[model samples]
Target: MESKGILTKLYSFLYIRGFKVWTSYRTQVALTILSWVLPVFTYYFVGTSLGNSLVERIGVKDYTSFFVIGLAFQGYVSSIITTVSGRIRNEQLYGTIEYYVLSRSGVTSFLFYSAIWGFAVNTINAFIIMSVGLGLGIKYDINWLSSIIISVLLILSTLGLSFLSAAFTMVIKQGNPISLFFSTFTTLLGGVVFPVTAMPIPLTYLSYALPLTWALQGLRGSFLDGEGIVQEGGIILVLLVFNVILIPIGVLAYKYAFRKAREKGTLSEY
Candidate 1:
């Protein structure tokens, strides 16, 4: 009974913390929604420009639907993964690092809770944007279950990569370069503008190793190709395997970095 109570309190705290963070900045939330709206318009124009050309290249019956789905999935992947690594820098600047370390709580659990909040906001954002796309007659067959699965795998990959970034931030006491490097590398290599297969062979090989490549492919394939998520079961399984392999390694690396920071007496420095 005592254990149950503790678990209940933890879950409640998680939800409350997420909500508090989300609601604390009403202006930012509004701006985020507004900013997302602009992209729908941009994509509509671009898809219109592509005209019949996109059909020959993208292989989708409806270029509008494909473009919208791609944009939505990209938003999902970017928002989900970027939050964790980005948190490290923000927390450091705001003097929240020591608070996180000295709270008599594990960092991993707290990170997971914080991600749930980010995920919630982004999911709502995606829905709103996609609804507008639907209004523009951009409709495609999608499997919610497969999307959830892809989301789970993407989150795991994001957590691992974020932990890696957090470790770098903690050790170096800097964030800009590492953050920019990862964001840029993934954005270009992970098919944000177009398909990975369109890249040269050498770059295509590198794309295979990128976690976003598979996650985005899985999401886009489902909606644009009229394929079910389960149809891409092999890739999904590979993502799950990658996550299982990386989590322990990430935790261990973070633990080592944390210990090093404490020993160097630089744990509190931003």
Candidate 2:
């Protein structure tokens, strides 16, 4: 009962902190929504201009739908990566790193909870983009159940990546090159704007190594092709493997980095 009470208080504190940060910047929130929505519109126009050729080449009926969904998933990926890395920097800058280190919740838990706001914002932006796509007459035959399952797996995989990012932040005490590299690499090669098959042979093979590639493929298979989890079994299996492998590795790396930072007396340093 005592442990439960502490856990509840920790969650409540984190929730309120996230809510306050979100509401404190109403203009930034509005602009962020606009930023996400405007790209869907631009893609709609560009996809239309490409006509049915992209459809024939990609095997999806509507290029706009394909592009939008890929971009939406990428948005979530980017958010998790950036938020996990940035949270440590923010705490350092605010001189609150010591508070977190001293907290009963522990540093890892604190960093994860601090990213709640970013995850929520990204989710809202994804929904807005999807809604705008539907409003623009981009049809989807989404398998909601399968999509949800894949989404959960994607989040777990992203959590692993975020943990790795957190580890980097703990050690480096600076900007997140990992987030930047993965964001750009996945956007370009993970079939965000185009199918990976369209890339050269070497790039095609390289894309398969990325978690986002399997994620986007699974999502597109579910949403665009209306495939169930069973139908997308191969992609699902790969993603599950990624989660199983990456999560433990990420956690160990983060703990090692945290220990190193403390040993170096750099936890509170920016």
Candidate 3:
């Protein structure tokens, strides 16, 4: 009876959908893992071919480390939108969204919890990419305090954006402007593959407006330039301003949108 009860609890509580797919197709899992590292080499070769001018333009000598940090960190920024919105999207299609919306803890926590695995996968992907960069001679001079501060700010900004995107998804059911904006422009303007300095001065102003751009600048400064939190105080301030403004706006939008959806009886509509 004890063994049967334990097995029943495991079956009830464990989510095996994504895991089952990976287990059934080991090759796909391996390739998906390998794909994360491949970009490090692509960027390295591109950086090498571009030569010293590339490094000089970015004002960072180590091209590998610069792009590596940019790429790894942007995953968290970009993934927050897709993951949270994707959960709501999936629930809508599965017709299980009504249950989530009616749950005591509600749709906000429901979507947040369901989307966590994607962030975990993003974390693993980041670790693998950074490890590959290390193998390719990218060096770090990390200041733990600065990294932690910048990371927390980045996460807060991401959560704010996540809620905003989720709010849009709940209503629109497709092609949210918030998600579209981030998806289309974040890689180009967020300093993921290149410094904002490399862009035209007007575009540089736009880049500075992005939370990812500030976060990456501070993160790279901490990891590569051994910058302390005090050294990156300006970046920290900008991120705090973003958190303060965006978080409340996001929460308000989420509550309003979710309430609108419920009122319209559109919970399961795709």
Best by TM-score: 2
lDDT for every model?
0.70, 0.82, 0.82
* Poorest stretch of ten by lDDT in candidate 2: 9-18
Provide the TM-score for each candidate, comma-separated.
Answer: 0.84, 0.92, 0.88
Model 1 accuracy (lDDT, Cα)? 0.70
Clashes of each: 0, 0, 0
Collision pairs in model 2: none
Candidate 1's residue-wise lDDT over 61-165, tens digit each?
565665565566556446644666666667778877788777655666556555565577677877887798789986657777787788778777766766666
Can you tell me which runs of candidate 1 are displaced by over 4 Å?
A: 1-16, 58-61, 176-178, 224-226
lDDT score, candidate 3 = 0.82
Clash pairs of candidate 1?
none
Score candidate 1 by TM-score against the native.
Answer: 0.84
Error of 1 at 151 (Å): 1.8
lDDT of 2 by residue, 1-270 (tens): 988976775566456666566668999878877889888888788877878975667666678888888888887788878877887888888888888788777888876765565677678878888888788787788999889888888888888888888889888877667788776678898888788998899999998888888988889889877999799888889999999998998889899999998999998788
Selected candidate, larger lDDT, 1 vs 2: 2
List runs of model 2 lying over 4 Å from the truth. Answer: 2-14
Query: lDDT at 182 for candidate 1?
Result: 50
